[model samples]
Target: MTWLPLLAAGPALAATTSRPWGVLCVGLLAAVLGAVLGIRDGVPGHELAIVLSALVAVTLASGLASALRVRRERVLAAVRSVAEAAQHALLKPVPATVGPFQVAVRYSAADAEARIGGDLYALVPTPYGVRLIVGDVRGKGLPAVGTAALVLGVFREAAYDEPDLLDVVGRIERSLARNLGPDDFVTAVVAGYPGAGRMEVVNCGHAPPLMVRDSHVMAVAPTHPTPPLGLRALTGETPSLQTLPFTDGDQLLLYTDGVTEARNHEREFYPLAERVARHMSDEPSRTLAALHDELLAYVGGRLHDDAALLLLRKPAAVGSAPAAESRASVGEPTRPSLLQ
Candidate 1:
């Protein structure tokens, strides 16, 4: 009779990983066992009834809890599906090749369940050239995501309409100034390859991009520091365009602070440039993949913040003829050479 109370644990444990029906089955089995045990011990009928009634109450409660849990899980799954769809629309996937450069991107949200976060990146082949932007919002969650979407939307439009690279940055700046709150801001690196063996970069208080030249990794620090987006009005300083030689076999890596700020058990930040030098490869995708794997392992299998990595490599020319220029939009079929 004393053991009859232990039967409640059967349904309680089942509620955690089984369906309501499974919990019901477990409860019914426990009740039957309790009855057998009570009779074998020659327990009083009233005492037996009391124990059985408590067991029944616990089982019913466990079944209801299981039902509610299953329903909540289904709702969460639907929410995640919608978030994924929104992410695809906001951060359209880039092809392996954009214009003359081989491009690769890797992004991870701090919230594993959210699947998308404040970190944002976009690479598109515009009439100006292959232009790309990598930026990190000031915060996380829904507000950060909305700010990132605003920046990308302005960038995609400005990259094509504006002839000058700085003008593209200007467009994003003005848009953010009008929309973002005084406390909100974004740090970004906007870069473009305009077909003159030169890569134009406009840094807005973001991490210095790593340039790989002749097997050497060097940080492309901005000559003139400027405030981040949405704070230009306060600082009254505009972003300056920095042009660098981007010849054949050269590569550039742009990433958010999350990569640099990631810490291990010892609280040591990830060495991005050093890792990039070690993982250098002819293919940008393979190189980023190796770096990303090492990064995750270095941080003990997870990053605490949203991290984004964009690597662009200019392949050595095969012939005098330039690669065919192409453009890709979301949901559109990519050209054979541009397929990722």
Candidate 2:
């Protein structure tokens, strides 16, 4: 779908901020100008009466409205500051230029800032190509956030030092085992981009990454899969790394259970594959927007848990060849937008 519907509300939302004063002043000027123009069509006494009444209304309305808006603005300003701080801590930032492809990210927590939980995504450039992780923590509040931070910290370091993707998974498991209780566990998908137009993926009880090429999506998962990260010790099994074919203009999307498990008013699960087929083009920025919008629509506005998505685009040509592909534009690390 086009983004027109989302753009329509931009002005309305801007109306609630300090910036709104500029718009309000412009509107008042327009009203005065219209009245002056109308005076040409009316008698002196009538025009004066109308102008006087309009002035009183404008003064009283602007005064009371300004006071109320100031209070609301103060609250929102504080909220935005805290949300931005938390967002930076939880999902730092990644470069748009990773090897060959451009990377862009959009993350949304169900609650404004202190309230968001359950979902997380991060991409860090490691010595072993660009390593990425996308997964959901099990619960909410500082506890869930702690679990998520635990996973990401282990993944980033392991991705650089460990040569094998599966080994990286093991490292994460050991870290969690030490930090989390025996019952606590996290489902995750960890992948290594070797920058050779190929990907090595290990699924630790997480959803498969959606592969896109030429605007088509191909499901990519290894024939052999492993249990979730924490459960490896419980199951006495280690996960295997899965390799899949990839080409330039192709992208791999790793998302949390939140996206697939999301339900609607009819209680039907969100159609992940179907929507991907429609929006999975050569452009990841657009693809992400479509997926994010579809997700919001499915849940009817607000999400109930933390949700995350990480997208990787493979270059059209690897090694010795230079071919430009789609890009994920990185924005200034401001508070993550509510739109996502």
Name the top TM-score candidate.
1
Listed per candidate, the RMSD to the true structure in angstroms reads 7.6, 12.0
Q: Tell me the TM-score of each prediction against the true structure.
A: 0.91, 0.69
lDDT of model 2, residue 133: 84
Error of 2 at 316 (Å): 2.3
Worst ten in a row by lDDT for model 2: 330-339
Please report the TM-score between candidate 1 and the true structure: 0.91
Local error of candidate 2 at residue 180 (angstroms): 0.8
Clashes of 2: 3
Predicted candidate 1 versus true structure: per-residue lDDT over 47-91, tens digit per residue: 999999998999999999999999999999999999899889988
> Per-residue lDDT tens digits of candidate 2, residues 30-57?
4555455556655365655555455445
Q: Backbone clashes per model, in order?
A: 0, 3
